[model samples]
Target: MEVDATALAGLQSEVSQLADLFKRRLFEDRSKNALIESVQDQVRAVNDLLRYREFEGLFKEALLAIDRLQSESSTPELVDSVVDELLEVFRRRDLVAVDDSGIFDPRVHEAIGTVPASADLRPNTIAAVHRTGYVLGDRLLRPAQVTVVVSVDD
Candidate 1:
């Protein structure tokens, strides 16, 4: 038996074409994989942003409780009950209110302004709290905005 020269050439051409097609397919697969990874990253970022928004909502709820207490129409007992319920929600989530009655710590407190120290008050001590802050476990959600007592001369 003998092989035809034209048949052999035709077979070689088909194999070469298949190899090129395979290489192109591999390249396209790589590009698809990269795009899939990018999309996943963007999805994760969006989820994180949504979680942050929820955290802000919690703070707003606390502010609303304060507002209710200040409004004369709302009874003190009703405001107290609302505040207690809100605090329980925070307790369940492991969110604790920051304590501002101490030496000012830059790590946990933000000094929004400074007041002249009284004869007994020490400098760098927290004088007033402008805004309440909270912490989840060891993570700081927000720093307490406070007024610091400063020496009158300085």
Candidate 2:
């Protein structure tokens, strides 16, 4: 079977037009996808800023309490009151103080130093705490700075 020259040329032209159409559609789809991704990123950035502003507003009172403690005239009672106020702010923001128990957990504790193990203190246990830590829900905001007890090497 032999295809006519005119018919063959017409088929080739039709195929070329189809190819060009496909290329144009592919480019348009890609452009549309890129624009959509850009919009989504912008929205996510806005949401993050809004969340930061909300947390900042919640800590305003805690900041004021801290400022009061900075004054030289602050007494022990005033210090205690300021501490309580700060804790209240943390609670309002769903933040909790990390528990620094005798047992040291690497997930929430940062070892600052080590002391020799004693009869009362077991190895790898917390001997002292230098700083307190906090957590926001399930996320760790800070690790407790603690001294761990190490076994005495002979």
Candidate 3:
């Protein structure tokens, strides 16, 4: 009994491809796990913030103000708990953006529109955020859509 050389070479090629596929799958799995962990950490932060009683009071009152907001028909207390935590997050200013630079980058700032301001004052600076932003590990959890002011050279 003897093995053919061509058959062995073909077998080796197949094995190599399989090995590469396994490696890629493993890397993807690890990358997805990291993303999941990062998201979980952010969720935990909100949960911790919501645990305060005062925050809960304010959150409930605000929700009650909603005209068409559904107050959770699925879980009895789940909606209340989650809303309190999320509202607490907003109330505490958990979402923030700080830039000493007088210029706004489109990547970091989603400019809804530009405003007119003095060159000595508002040189392309971030005026205000239309919506709040979130941060995670030095990465933007959400980009702040803000209005920036540009100084026109007269």
lDDT by residue for model 3 (37-119), tens: 99999999888876776467656666664422464454646666665655555545444453424478766667887778864
Q: What is the alpha-carbon lDDT for the whole of candidate 3?
A: 0.70
How many clashes show up per model? 0, 0, 0
Candidate 2 residue lDDT tens string, 1-154:
9989999999999999999999999999999999999999999999999998987877788779878888657788998888898888888888898888878899999999999998998999989999998999899999999999999989
* Backbone clashes (count) for model 2: 0
**Descending-TM-score candidate ranking:** 2, 1, 3
What candidate 1 gets wrong by more than 4 Å, as runs, is 1-73
RMSD of 1: 7.0
Report the lDDT tens digits of candidate 1 across residue range 7-47.
99999999999999999999999999999999999999999
Task: State which candidate has the highest lDDT.
Answer: 2
- What is the TM-score of candidate 3? 0.36
**What is the lDDT of every predicted structure here?**
0.89, 0.91, 0.70
